[model samples]
Target: MTTPAGSGSGFGSVSWWGLSPAVDLQAESPPVDPDLQADTEHGTPDLSVLLLGSTDGRHLLRTLARAALWPQRRFQFYVLENNLEAVARHMLIFSLALEDPEKMGLQEKSETFLEMWGNALLRPPVAAFVRAQADRLAHLVPEPDRLAEQLPWLNLGALKFRERDALEAVFRFWAGGEKGPEAFPMSRLWDSRLRHYLGSRYDARRGVSDWDLHMKLHDRGARVIHTREFRRWRDTGVAFELRDSSAYHVPNRTLASRSPPEPSWGAHCSARVLGGHRHGALCGLRHRSGRRKPPADQQRAASQATPLLSPETAGEITLHNVTEVFREITAWWRPRAAQGDPEQVRGDGDGSPEPAGPALESFTVHFLSLGSAQTLHHKSCYKGRFQLLYVACGMVHLLGPELGACVAPGGRLIVELAQYLVDLRQEQLQGFSTKVGELAQTAGFAPHPGAKPSETLARFYKAGDSGSGCMDLTVEPGTPPP
Candidate 1:
């Protein structure tokens, strides 16, 4: 069944296929003329189109030519490319007959040349030719502000066309003083503009121009309108490829390549989009208030508040310092195994401890538990050395040389014993007393000892054996150790 047109101006009746049967162009012509005339008088042309082409030149040219033939209205087309001079001459000659179609013989020749050029520009092998045409047309039109106001939309990079004059204004504002095709930073044009305004860059290195352009516009506060109606002519001699050619592909991969990679398990962990009553309520309130709640409020209403994690805030966590903590932990663990068995302490080929090997350089740090279990296991062996065992969540565990046999999940290092168990639960087992004595004695043997017998014993009990046994610590100050 044919869909009935929604309520709007007569423009609503115009579909991808042009005006519907109910709205005859001949019958509607007189009424539309007044509106068109009024728009023209206001210095806004009835319609102006900016055709951006590099590879799909023929397709766009033919599309514009056919569109120009619309019986009821005339559209002024501005083709932007790198070389404005050549395209200006070509278009002038091509449209000479149409400019005065009453002339004999010239009509067929003009039409034939238009078709020939269109076919050449649309073909895959003629991408260079298409690009040349685009280069020639880029500088032909003057008064961009007039075009911006006159044209309802402008096409850039790929998605056909967009109605965001602010974007074009930004481009024109930046590409100042520079002239000719040489001045245009075709590849990085979108990237630089997006980065300048939105603090984000487009990755056009992968031949993903269209998606990048859309994202760039979106990043810069542009609201894209998704229409069901087709906007451009399909199968107009241009071949559409869902995947781009390797030659046009951008090099840098991964979203992080757009900027620095986010640190592993930092404060800025990625989250899934959640929608429901709780989200709706908080977001609704925030939207109405036009301000975000304070951090204290977030902490107080942790269950309702979304995680306050972002790249900007994550930088404050000092991930670089975490590396030092990891190294300390590795040193502590290796000695413990060595003391248990000297043969096992022997260094591997890479100078790491046997079995566990050298210290881990990198590993995935899980913030939350798998399920009812709250175990955090480091999967891959770090730096081809030590295989990290499950450690307690929240608490920072340090490693040192004089360690002994202890539970896998939690065992406080002598150096940072006091700070480690400050926010943990006390254990009720004989193992705590024995382990603490051993740890304290070992600490005393070190060149610079920090742990006391009393402190070690207190921390031992506080440290849990299994990850689940560990207490859920809070990010607060002044908590007593154990």
Candidate 2:
């Protein structure tokens, strides 16, 4: 069971992809495309950004206007608001014109929200927008069977807006990494949407695309930035967090807030609120089994639901089907994995192995946030066969071996959060990685002695990999278990 020298997953020799810790320090940066540079010089900067799920057209238009840092340096914009009616409403209020519908057998456009607002007509721009709609209707040149192909004029130019049903196409555009027609970012900076916002600090560019700066201080306020891969996953099946503004039944916070002094477990899970407003850390749970059926209402509204991160598995899953998954992962999934059943090795679907379950109460799971690993290590419940899983969580202080020491003889340990946070927060990259094998070794575990170095993505620290037995679970932290 002894791992060979430079092979015990100790960030051994460096690799070309820089995936390994022992990666060549002399590795060069990814090459920038020469054509992209030429395009930048020639007026258009090959960069095209798509604003996804924009509720209104106002932000979309304003962001595009700001992103034009130079007079002629306009970036191409693709918008898909995920709501067809909202898109129509925005077009009506923004002085846009859609082709007449009589030729297409569709009913005439009804009175829009802006039209209903009597005061809106008093504004010069609003009155102009209404007048344009009347002109388009009176001067009907509607062509039959051309609604899908016809352009909707916004400010005299055709706007590239798609339907909500085109979610797949929108996601494909994001997921595509420098490939095919949607591969518009010709620059090597990063293959994701460029969020534009006005800067607050002096000397900082009036318009900025950096995520942290814009998301924190931009005039539009804090916005969450998702990786291209995360977006693709969300579009496919994952549900967005329940607290997301896009969720189906948005909870009225004033009525739903958890009474204060919060849960004792809140100490374990610390969320960083951006604007000094206290928002509880969102806990999304999904059953690895994927056997649980969704409720009748959720099933009907599934297509419109926003996606969320699935804690138990890597990809996206349902968010509304929460009542049960929470109970199952802590009570069912982890405990079953701790048992080491060969049948349970293959997840119910997808064919990939699921992480060994991290035990919590059969019903309630305490927070598994920033410093959760250390918190779990100190808790009595994590004593024997219990495992620890840190999903796309923040980078906090805790070593690998400190956690590896807690694994029982038949249990497993998986840590994606630490490596992810380091790569994302420190390296300023879209993905995550544990520094070579430093995380695993420090966690007091090693790659399975028999596994090849290429299998670094999922290094299962099997039971007995370290001779260290479970530590005394009696030493409790000052805050006793609820």
Candidate 3:
């Protein structure tokens, strides 16, 4: 079960666990799409990996090279590039490490790619690093098929290029379907764009950070299976920064159009099974390919799972937002009978302001943890019975659709996002609240007219009758609890 001594070089000398048994090299193949099969013909490895990366700036090529050296070699790669010069650099790296260049068909492709985008390619020093990493990988490729078996889940970061919106959902959809962490590298890799590329100024106000993206992914279902292994790109003397005044554009057309016109054979096999109680709770998760569902057994298991929220329940629940802060929002409950005005107090002779009315008839409040905002949309948990309050701007903007789905006809979603954050550029803050309201409305909540300016708040009511109109949570202006 163990890889012999001297194997898995440059991939950290540590032993990896959970590698599946070696695949039968001579076994009969299962029926697959002819196009996919054709891609594997002519001595190429059976397993395919799609790698998408940028040409310059800091990257994971070293990490990837280390992974390529992992014992087992069944993987064949399709390198796609977001940066115009990425393909050339990756090709150079792969060429140095990979065996049988003419047979692997890399050399010809590298020449073509370099010819097409040579102007934008990496500098000589970075090119030298790729070759060095490739040299390290060359010693590790004992058998390509074994490597393939161990790398089923590699290159998930590549999907970042494809699924820019709803990153959590897209990531969940992919990770949920694929084999577990055993197939990927055991290292925490920072997203490269964080340091070099500044996103829109408007998004900066909405708490859009790369950290938020990682947190969202974690919350949705992708766990980081490894500890951080720090790596930095060697300075090539050329400045990597994208100047604000320069017109920067992503040349994605070639990469985008490369996917086969027909759905690949692997699509059906990788469809994810939504499991446990969450199956019903997160009904918003749909197949990424939109082609097929998981097998019948998975569907049955999901259907039988208990629902998280019941329709007949009449209790209060408090949940935290993405910021992990628990803000107090008051809910009033009264005995069906015997209510002598819960808000009024009898006059006291001492003239001391009558204690704000005795605790309004004993009531129970159910406080749920943060990220309930995500689940609400999945389960239609709020059947328009009462209003929902959201305090975080990130939750409203980043996850509007999920929250909107929870609102039943006649329920209102009250969101409070302060407009005057001094850190944000004035241009970014302009119409910021209005944009948030528009985003919420688009997600399913119908706009309500009573939003006030002082609170920096917006009210969106789910279309329908709650019997009691517009239930607002009375929270004083202040920071939420940690």
Candidate 4:
């Protein structure tokens, strides 16, 4: 499906979400995420999207960076996050985009960005950059005027004052103290947690790390994640295999999340089925709610469907990060266009200010705090407002029956299925599907007719627009949803 790294890498729109066989959903008109390309079309409708808790920067690169830019197409993204850290990280990413291209290339920036995201520890420069942004944001988050003056794209008016204050504290924590080897000292804490989590198995951490990556992640079609990085993150609390820096000892506070407390987690989770091949891959995914195991018959069915990884698997998969996989998503927008002209293009390789191109425009992103409320009755007028409502895999468990109310009649709703979640945590595949379908039905939605779902994803659309919403190309008009 991939050609190679070409000259125009990071200049198109694409995604690794595997939304469908057609690929590059953003490359089409009415892109998944709005790109900042120069527009040739005269009249185009505005795009509004709502996202929950997928902090992958896909909006900026994967979704928005696709296709020809349109001047008339104004894009508004309503980003709903559970906590302050997500907003802070989003701001940090924005800061990276706005950095001077002369000093840091897009590829370098991508590398830095991903590491800062996945890794628990960071390189010296990465740490320094986070600290600098945090120091600035710490001050601005408290003062609305200053924040608007600086980071104009962000709209936090939807957030409560206390939420904003909490976010400021999150930024201050990232900023760290005046002088100390470690400000928050998360590394030690990580080690302690690791030790406790892996009491007897602690000595075999290397093997365990390798097992987790090769078995669980690789099996789930995450070939992009390399063994070395995964193992490193497991062993030393570091995800990215960057040039070693002494600063790696410092824990990345951004990686932390304030999750709703669960009861007696880590009970057991193992992916032991792939079709009929049982790999017996032991995944750390656990039953957090303290739920009981299903009946023997159900578990047997689940096991047959849930495949695990084989410890014997060798051959380290050379990691293909998001950019490598979604080459078009690699292209990024600068925070600020150079003083001379918005059309001026930064030299693809060389730092030469070139002739006029597409006028650089900014999109507004509203960051709102998502509460634990089961229904999304945020506003009375919020009904049928968004074209696309996406629920990230990590947030899928929070899916409510009335969630579809937020999506427009003809719009699409995508929920990333947490792999093997049904097999272990909930009921087997049938039950899981039925539960979700019931919810969607209650909310005036139906399984999207156009979509051909894999083991990984589920797509739906409001009942009004069933006109072949499927992106799958293999099946003509697509198979009927079972």
Output the number of the TM-score-best candidate: 4
Native-to-model Cα distance after best TM-score fit, residue 20 in candidate 1, in Å? 19
Note the Cα lDDT for every prediction shown. Answer: 0.24, 0.27, 0.28, 0.51
RMSDs, each prediction?
Answer: 34.4, 27.4, 28.5, 13.7
Q: Given candidate 3, what's the lDDT at residue 133?
A: 38
Per-candidate count of clashing residue pairs (backbone under 3 Å):
14, 19, 10, 19
For model 3, give the 10-residue run with minimal summed lDDT. 314-323
Residue 42 accuracy (lDDT) in model 3: 40
lDDT of 3 at 56: 19
- Candidate 3: lDDT of 119? 15
Q: What is the per-residue lDDT of model 3 for residues 13-40, given as tens digits with 9 covering 90 to 100?
A: 1111101111111110111223433333
Write the number of the candidate with greater lDDT, choosing between 2 and 4. 4
Off by over 4 Å in 1: 1-127, 131-185, 200-245, 249-482
The number of the candidate with the highest lDDT is 4
- For model 4 the local lDDT of residue 80 reads 72
lDDT of 3 at 89: 34
Off by over 4 Å in 2: 1-382, 388-392, 417-436, 448-458, 463-482
Q: How many backbone clashes does candidate 3 have?
A: 10
